[model samples]
Target: MEDDKHSLGLRVIHWLMAIFIIGMLCSGLYMKSLPLSNEIKFNIYAIHKACGITILGLIIVRIFFRVFTYVPPLPANFSRFVINISKAVHFGLYSLMVLMPLSGYVMSSASGKQIKYFFHIPLLINQNKDLANTANELHSMLAYFIVLFIILHMLGALKHTFIGKQNIFKRMI
Candidate 1:
């Protein structure tokens, strides 16, 4: 049935966010390991900040669309346990998606660093070392949780598609 599949717009946004989030996670880790004085590291940092800001904007758009859209329900055959776990994982993913970038922006802002949109337009904020340190810690903590949630989400979909014969992956595709 048509209702089983996510809307085309939702699917597109879902895939786009997936790609961007994965890239951000990878680059963020790589950026951290590199020496601060490295030119490549600075370039990566700029790209990371720009992408984080872009992701924040996309999250706003996603919330707006989610409000007006009909989200397809999980397959009926799944156990209540599975359903509840799925809901929790979805919630975790959404929460992390919003929080990660927000904390990044807050950290940057509190550190007196102006985050330029796409490495050009300046978005300014006041500086506070205390808040910057706090936000930075929170942002760092979130990275691990987001990775866990993403893995759970993917494994669930794969299990449903291949083991359970639910074809759940097709809903988003």
Candidate 2:
């Protein structure tokens, strides 16, 4: 039987999303590491916010396409445990992708900071300091998990490509 594959557009968007996510993660970590003032931190955060919002938009489109498109199934020989784990990881990734930016936006808005998307329109959410702090904490903690998952994801893809001799990497490329 012929191998099922992702559509070209889906593949392109997938890889682009991956790049944006990595960029956001790196910039976020760097911004956190800096000993800058709140204003400076906010400026850095604006960039992060822009990247994150872009990612959120891309993810929405990806999710829409996923629902409508005919995505290829995983290998039949794949174990149930592996399949379950994959589902859990995918769920986590999607949930975090949606929540992280929303949390950041809430944090900014609550602190009386404007959430600017690049040079585009600003996001103005109602202020709530208590909620903002909670979101901020969740965003920070989830970031560590994102980093770990990304590392594992990369390792898994490499294993599939090098050892399994599968075209798993090509699916996203």
Candidate 3:
């Protein structure tokens, strides 16, 4: 059986994650591009860290929701190859959604930077520069892949809506 749209919980999580991830990406790019003072940059980094932590929590909840919820099947006309590709894209997105925040948290914690939830809760761990550098490199590398996958995902949705007239985008709405 298939439904025309996603559940309310799924839609809520999707939009919330989209907003948070976009904000984190824009802030990260801007922070890297300018010659900002160390203090200012540090402040921005703190905000990013807080957002990342929140995203991490959301992703955890999303995982549970995904396991418990029923996902609609693709249109019957969709070929096996198309279904496989769709699965791959969804898997990639979910993987990055979890990894991106996790890698950031590791980088921050290992680099001796404090990671607090809204500047109130303490989330400190033992410092390890080597681990920090590794996590940072992984996070940096994955960012490009994430962006690429996101664009591809969006294009697929647009194609379904405009070219195929499949109404696939409505499933997520």
Candidate 4:
């Protein structure tokens, strides 16, 4: 892989994850607004759940990949402020990516809902109503932070790519 961009494996995972996360976000929001007990709603909810579990697995792999790989350096003239924000945004994004799915799993399990991967493989985790309720609330609240961090991450990339003429996105492409 070129020093200007991410490795092919990372790029593939990054784009694949971007698409899946967007899909998961939209589906989750739609499902939350739908009336319960409807068939379509149920199906969409199931899909969302499956995707969440899949993302959890993928994120685990991604974390390992990230830990073992080297990222391209920032531009020589980049300010400390920019570099600090970059670190924070990336840290926030990774934290949310890992926590979001775990929280959802806890929420589902606590509610005594079986987690199925693609509606096939069963995920057997502990169940507790109180725990589920707590995780459910936390998951809902944590989503705001995730959205905020994602927007910040994108904005930083755009700033570097367009304004700074750094083409930082090339590293991720």
Candidate 5:
């Protein structure tokens, strides 16, 4: 198979997104482990919210570039099952990327917290206790799924890089 290349813009955004996501995940786990307190929880939530919004923006730009550019194709020797799994994984990643933040926004809005976007503006949604609770639960649950997906993703990438000896990892870099 030909060595697939990533566009400079895509590569930059991809790495930035990866760093942002990893940071957010760490912050989130830390926040979850902390005791509920106004000062500490509020600060962590603010940072988490900011990161989520930034990720949303970056994801939008990534999608636009993905639609316009030609990403490298999978290796020809790759089996159809492997190809199908890759497609499924990609779909899940994108879907979670979009949904996780939206769920968090809904949860924050429902709890009557000021949804600050990078300290730029405060967003408000209708205050409904039930809705907020539901969103919070969904967000929490999806977070676990996202964490699992990420682990699987990293394992797969490592397999391609070391075991499979494929260019999949290099193409992204």
Candidate 6:
């Protein structure tokens, strides 16, 4: 059981990233649907940007931990195809984890909005209308892909936990 589990640091970071990512996705959608003149909408935007930057920092730490830690292997019973799919899903998730926040930062920075880490420290970045638009478009498009990948990841974990009786979820726990 011990051998099958991820390191404590990894598990904690994984869950933290998951929570932030899910929150960001939902808040982002909600903010977009809100009226431009809404005061609460701007507040949500500030919080969203702050959380996005936090996610970016967490992701960097997550990557560093992932590199230096021992990652538990998947169940031995999983077939080659299943393993391949799992790898692909993880790759996609990791990529999006980095890209999503980065795109958001670029969008905010280019739009001439000063980004504050947790609503305090300022991050210096130049504004460019064209770049802002481009980043916004990319960030918007990436949202769908991130959602899809997250669903796939959850489904795969569910399959292993219930159908396969592998109890793979224990690893993260």
Error of 6 at 130 (Å): 1.8
| TM-scores, all models, native as reference | 0.93, 0.86, 0.92, 0.92, 0.91, 0.94
lDDT top scorer? 6
How many collisions per candidate? Answer: 0, 0, 0, 2, 0, 0
Alpha-carbon lDDT, every model: 0.89, 0.77, 0.84, 0.82, 0.83, 0.89
lDDT digits (tens) for residues 143-167 of candidate 4: 7888898899899999888998988
Tens-digit per-residue lDDT, 103-159, candidate 2: 777777776676577565454766778877887898898888888777767777787
Residue-by-residue lDDT tens digits, candidate 1, 29-142: 998899978899978887898999888888888877777888888878889999999989988998999999989988988887767774554445678899999998999999
Q: At residue 100, give the lDDT of candidate 4.
A: 88
Please identify which of the two predictions, 2 or 5, would achieve the higher TM-score against the true structure: 5
- Tens-digit lDDT string for candidate 6 (55-161): 88888988888899989888888899999999999999999989998899888888888776635644456878999999999999999999999999999999899
Question: lDDT (0-100) at residue 152 of candidate 2?
Answer: 69
Runs off by more than 4 Å, candidate 6? 118-125
lDDT of 4 at 6: 59
Q: Model 5: which residue pairs collide?
A: none
Candidate 4 vs 5: which has more lDDT: 5
Ranking by lDDT: 6, 1, 3, 5, 4, 2
RMSD vs true structure, all candidates: 1.7, 2.4, 2.0, 1.8, 1.9, 1.5
Model 6: how far residue 114 lies from native, Å: 0.5
Worst 10 residues of 6 by lDDT: 116-125
Q: Give residue 64's error in model 4 in angstroms.
A: 1.6
lDDT of each residue in 102-161, candidate 3, tens digit only: 899888888877786856535365789999999999998888888888898899889888
Model 3 CA lDDT for position 36: 68
